[model samples]
Target: MKYNEFLPITLEEMKARGWERADFIVITGDAYIDHPSFGAAVISRTLESAGYKVGIISQPNWRNVGDFKKLGKPKYGFLITAGNIDSMVNHYTVSKRRREKDYYSPGGKMGLRPDRASIVYCNMVKQAYKGVPIIIGGIEASLRRFAHYDYWSDKVRRSILFDSEADLLVFGMGEHQILEIAESLKNGLDIQYMHHIAGTCYKSDTKENLYHFIELPSYETIATDKIAYARAFKIQYEEQDAVRGKVLVQPHGNSYIVQNPPAMPLSEVELDRIYSLPYARKVHPIYEKDGGVPAIEEVKHSIISSRGCFGSCSFCALTFHQGRVIQSRSHTSILEEAEKIVKSEDFKGYIHDVGGPTANFRNIACEKQKKEGTCKNKQCLYPHPCRNLNVDHGEYLDLLRKLRKIKGVKKVFVRSGLRYDYIISDPKDTFLKELCEHHISGQLKVAPEHISPKVLDLMGKPRREVYDKFVDKYYKINQSLGKEQYLVPYLMSSHPGSDLKAAVEMAEYLRDIRYYPEQVQDFYPTPGTLSTCMFYTGLDPRNMKPVYVPKDRDEKAMQRALLQFKNPKNYELVKKALILAGRKDLIGFGPKALIKPLGKERQNIREVKYSNKKPATKNRNSSKNTKKR
Candidate 1:
């Protein structure tokens, strides 16, 4: 029952004792992946580094009163977060015909769990320990920072802070915000006065005092639609409305405020201070005691070399939270952490993966010199081969090589999918070839998203030709090395411009390449994202151009099926697609066709006694004339 009881004991023992308070506890519905790469691991480690004793309750199956009691009382309070489990948005369709077994979970359905994980966790914490302050963070709490559209229910849901009954919701990256909260609480600071934090949402007792309290700029105009959202937020999409960007809105309270991003990227000293913490690479006692681990098998004891992304995909939230500028740890610091993983007993041959938003892109910047410069353009996530940023792979390549040489390290793999266009874009192919030969485990994953020029343009992806060139070169290198490694290109369905024709073309491309993807992700419009805004508003917010949007669930489902031509159920979809493509002949003849031809003997019709048939009148008359002659 004691905090230092090294030997893990039952929850009953902890409950029996009246020890119902601790320094701090994290209430999360996400699986603890023990590695530093995940949200729970990083945040917990950061808090621990700041001298707070933290305990994690990862992915509790049932978030009830009993669950809270299991995690022995915290000394401080509770940090409630959903970690990386998407508790905010519903990613699955309700129709049974549309739902497919997740490739990741085998039989599991994709969507928000019925019993809200974050909400239940918060309620359980409050019920178990009275007067204890609870702080919530992560995607579930962050994206729901304001009143936004909920796709699952097809309605605007209230701010998560009010709905979850938590003290505060930390939006965006919580590295500094969480530390500030803990320090404030320890110093006897009340939750009511903690509204000054930039990336957080909290409720106030006084409604009249809200406007003067925080001066968030009006980002609502841009946030109102996806194009504007992408243009303003996408890291690589540099054309931002200089005066209009970085505005914050309290949708629930009907208030507006603005806070600038961290003036400069986190310094190495700051990063070291944060990433250097004693991380216990093990499952939380509560989860092990309960006999469950959601992503246990996939958990690779991971370490991050960098933070943020330069290739700002329009749909991604990383640029919004971490910024487009890449921040990295010293090579020494990264190696030191890698050594710890090598030393851990729990570590297998796999290090899970080592990379950030874009794995190969490390230690890059758009500016020639580090200075305070404002971006005014709207569409920052688009236009292939980002003109603003300098792409570098040397430092990353060196790190990868060094990691592989580390003693006790069996295999240092790059599980994160590479940005293929970026990799091939490098003038020197040595880095890429080495990456393919050393990092890959017979398969390298890449995201081409779509093959159509228009779709790719809309998605802010590199041209299809760029992907094609990379594929050709990648395969040639593989052949030379006599390696059977393959490039697994990920594709998306039902984007803003992706019509039935585009979907069919993509399917045909997949068939031509014989890339039968086992998994196909249907586009889910997450709140606060540009894609979601586009989904809601038909026009592109950037240029005010008319865009084709598919709202029909059935059309979306068919588009998804087109990606997975190998699935037997998709045979009809392939047939229909062929007809739609004006290639009906392909339906019965092509190799991609579901049905094959029978031999000549089977094609011939046989006459049976019971069969109804008409006599051959023309043949009989001709025979009679011949006989007379």
Candidate 2:
């Protein structure tokens, strides 16, 4: 079979391919790169493989209708996305400042796409082609498919299905939903009547068609009442599963947004076929003159061995989007992809990465999850590992071993975020041993996020002690393997439940380790995260208990500064943070001081340090040592 070189992007290309119109036109906020890593490419290709002619319109000019009308009109419908990353996230910094560069754009150019791109592009399509079906998905639409807190807007907004005025919203990985939607459209089914498809959301005037679906709080109620909003998020979080997941519905005035349950996780053979799909595997030649798309470089030589993550960090929307179960490509499929990478001119005898969201998770967390679904009440690795969690890493190790053995492949690195909790949960040391010896170049990236127990629990991360144990094991493995390596722990600040005291505690821990974080991640409350729910409502959705959120600009900055206290620029912020948290003792030039007392106060400053000590404010989570399982 002749494979697709690149889906037509222009009228000339369309004519050259002998196509008058495409079956589907994929509108993306990112520059067109026909690689599987880009969602638009995968969705478009998935349609193309099913005998549908799919076209790509990437980073179109939203101010006018010409770019939207470039493909004339799709024979079936339009598939729109805000690219791999959310548009708002792509546009703004955590401090709500406009970003100077967009990785998905050509030459890392800024402002190629508008803010709230999914909404903007959908409206543009409607204006360009009247009455054509527009289906929105990708991370932006998937996470905001329900009434969600929009940080950029600083308010709870209605689902994208309504906001975009699109006919359908495909949440999660849309390969399944896209295929079904394409086939239905080809069979002459109306987009409105195509509401029964799983992993898709549609707006309806009545709830009569939905069966066994839970009704969440109305948009009006959630927008006004924080408790109701928290409650709504709680229900949404618990019900996001493929197996045993029920349909969910939320109301907005006269209509209901009905979300069908997520599609079943792809099987091993099915996932393998998707990665093996004919992809151009490079930025389109159109983008080459503009220094190419910056996003493709990271993924060019990499192999996505799996999809879906069960790590379920509170700040992560993977739980609400990809769901908890793991779906991986087969070993044969991965090796085949690796062999192709080896043949490339720029290979350099190195396989850059071989993993998914969480590199180590290659299967379902437990036997029960395979049939009954992830427990709505329990987590696989938070609080503590479940008694039934399957912790074997044998299969993943073997896959790595085979990739290492592949000809012309010198190194196979696991660069994705590896769950440290999952690592220590295993009784065997072989995975860690092999990891240090064969996988990493030097430093492995892990996300402990914070060392404060209260913040860790609220972030749905494992306890501080879990990170400690993992660190010890990591170093020990490196020492035994006769390799010199380091650990780069990804930490966050200003998350809910992280008060000044917690931030100070984190700073002190970093001091103890003699490691200072060069870059601090200030929590940005994006849509559909449990932590974002808490950030917006000031209450943990799990229990409706108040959480002290660091929302003030000064407090957020101070928290971020405390993490990098050793930086000379953060001296004043760290000193102020110490005084506010009643940790004035940490301000002097003593052995444990976070910062030296300013100016002449350095003269035996211990005597005057207590003068500025203010009583520490109330900590809502200080007494709550354990996660609420």
Candidate 3:
């Protein structure tokens, strides 16, 4: 249970002199889970499986220096990654009116500042052990892989490599790249000489060498515009196109150099191999006895599934990272893990949600097609679902049924948002009904972003009517089963083409449904994302057409307030919106009410003052004559 137990060396009196020769460690700033499904966890496990020793430093209170010391001394090298966390981006509201609440950090106030945390962690590791190689991966380092504009800071940022002070920065998916780096170090190859690997970024030997870049996927191709980006990569709801390609590499002070296209996505067998690592449900005894990840009070467990998104919301980044393929583990693997959870002393009643992007769609399709070799198309956020892609509810239904049967399992739940369209699309309605009856604990969260067709088209979401039909059907099914559950629809505000009018219409739709959401997300422009470009450029990058974009703060606030009429202030806001939208007629006003006042009344005061002397004289004379009579 001591810090030095896992380390090959001791750092009792480290201030005097530093030691060399590490056992090669991969230290991550991500939370450690037994299952290596996530990027950071998987990479760490991958390195360990390849014969290199790895230790996870998950979700450390990075502000404290002692937290870093707890990992002990690294005998070889260190791999530093924040997993899927992005450092360069800050939470922002595109709404015209900014509130104090809007400034609060996302996931509540306690969330760590990602960029600051990464920098501090990297520095602390280096100070503790000199000459240790620190490599940065995950979204934090990937999208910020080059010099780019940061909307949050409103400034251009250098590559994360320079900012984090890590030796090498790997962009895109890190599976193959991280493994290569670890193997080379274990074989006694210099870390500096390993830059030739694709999907990695390192400082060049000379300045001239920086410009002579390797050809990878062009950011220009993807960055042409939002529509173009969406068209190229967006996933249609039913289509299964696994378009894996090379990492788009941009060296310092040079144009984008894309590496070889993505390797064949990890097959089911490879995926199963990675997920099946012997991960301790709780932290290792040594680290856990002291306060490590899954802290003293928190339960320690890892996520089990990855990939498969049926929602196909245009603004999401999951489809880009994990792809649209619905790949899941065998039911036996899930049950085996559940049993392990029950056996663990630290097992709390909570087995955090079991899902990838979309939880419900599991082992839903086969890889090969009947006639076609493999589907190459990628955008699933289309109007209609795909015919080739299978929609089978039987496998997932059986899996859910089995998971509930685990003896020690208090409550097995599905926390990930469900794709109602896909659920209804299933040939049998049994899965939907059963899911509503058992899985939900009163409230089931769904994302029906907007009710307006114009807005839905822009978002690539199902029609408003589709959501309405699902809502009615959901309630009916719940009633039939004698269960009480309400649908919580996730809505977005101020997306591209969501003008004040469209926002007003959406608000009206919400009011008609008699539902008020506690959370409403303002669209933020993440780099390399389609929506972000559309927001910044003001033109659809695909067609170069001017899109209706609302940039005013007050307008955004008005739109946001319209959806929540529960607030008394919003009543006034609705009136203002009606007037601003030039729908005063909708307020039952006539032409007279709408017209401006005439000039005679406006000029009367001045005219009366100027003509006062003559008028007063004539009146006084008439009054004097009347008094005398």
Candidate 4:
């Protein structure tokens, strides 16, 4: 159909669509934006395409069951998500302060939805309609499918399946698994039987049929024991692949939560079809009065040409959420979308981003990855590029070249990350030359994370020398192309292995490069990532090796300050950190100093400058002269 034919949201809209009842009532924590970037929109639209009637309840009021019953009971079940991001992460800052604004809400308003949105919404639905299937999905449910450490709660939380009392949990990208669930329900299969579907998690009273699967430590064991928690996380991490992955079972109270192997990556044609579906590509017009959803502006002009990331950064949740297998759309598919975008009334000459999880990853890591899933233990680009890595950007480069030639498109920018180490490994320098010559607006953002080898090793990032090598190559290519582009390296502080000494080392490296990052991320330990496990358990889950975790609040702030030590506000914290790390030498006015020491003279001057009134030196001198007279 057309873009205006969005799925039914209100009873009147349902009547207009000639539907008396929806097959699924989808509740979300975010305002309804019918764009592909919104998970609820995509899942609903995909179901609609399959002749299943779907209605949306966006940002439902969760204090009562009123908003949950707005769409009425569905014929089959209810699908719930905590929007694009986990609700807790969206509502609270890493420091546990409630944020004042929400990008997913209309007019960017806060408190549009409650915390732990998925669980709250599910409970509301459960209270409203007993015996109806309640399915939880999206970032919140997916990451918490097993017992995971909740940063906000500061304790291990049980599987969301148990907390929400939902029948099933759909983890990862749910295109395939969702369709299967819908089909099974439509064919008269019970929700319990839907457990066999890939990319789904279900609770069972008994593990009678569970075969050839690894069992994680029970919830009681993990919640009370950090080592057991770390061990459980490693087993879950390894069994996330589609090919080699097996069912993973974890005990929760008296029952068990079982996660089926991940769904297979979509083929080019399948991915193309999913993107080409008639998406309204905008926030629902109903939200116009309160101002449109702010989140839409970021992706309205961008194209998700691919999915999944093989970069495998330890701190990233993509591996757990989307898997590591890179699945990309055909160049033809992307060009067609570009043509549509150019014809839009709002088409500015720019295509904001032309990539997905990792922009340059347009194909699987290696040819063998397609037949056998990504290696469970070994990383593709970390430590070093795998010997068998097929590093060819030919397809991606050609895609960019064609998009550039589009009539109304002025620029095709790779706003998403470009894995630099991957680029340097390529035999041809054509992608690098073109990237610097055309794609870059001025500065390209790359993630080096940290300069310390110890920290980088824990982060699953390339060595410090590897990033330096790439930086050198990037500038060289830019110089050859007569471009004055800069590299904005993304840095993170307070990661698990980052001690005070490591933080100081990072500060020294920044001083040498003469680069002061305007923004630095203090590593946030969200659920379902290797790094988060390390942060919580103080051990590398992969090897159960003890890792030094900087858990002290003051120390984390110090680490953050060290990254931006050039800032006057952070000078004191940097100095404190330098002294603690035994790098007191970094607190001077020398070339090697990270911060200027707050000596008595400097402190007095700073106090005077900060005060509204000037120092009393003039008054004292006048009084002294008067006394002399």
Each model's lDDT: 0.63, 0.89, 0.59, 0.89
Against the correct fold, how does model 3 do in TM-score?
0.75
Candidate 2, 100: how far from true, in Å? 1.1
Best by TM-score: 2
Runs in model 4 lying further than 4 Å from the true structure:
1-4, 601-629
Query: Of models 1 and 3, which has the larger TM-score?
Result: 1
Across 309-400, the per-residue lDDT of candidate 4 in tens digits comes to 99999999999999999999998898999898888788989999999889999988998888888898898988899999989999899999
Clashes of each: 25, 0, 29, 0
- Model 3: ten consecutive residues of lowest lDDT: 99-108
Q: In model 3, state the lDDT of residue 589.
A: 23
CA RMSD, predictions in order:
6.8, 8.1, 9.6, 5.2
Candidate 2: C-alpha lDDT: 0.89
lDDT of 1: 0.63
Q: What is residue 591's positional error in candidate 1, in angstroms?
A: 7.4
Residue 472 deviation, candidate 2, in Å? 1.5
Candidate 3 lDDT for residue 314 = 63
Better structure of 1 and 2 per TM-score? 2
Clashes of 4: 0
Best-matching candidate per lDDT: 4
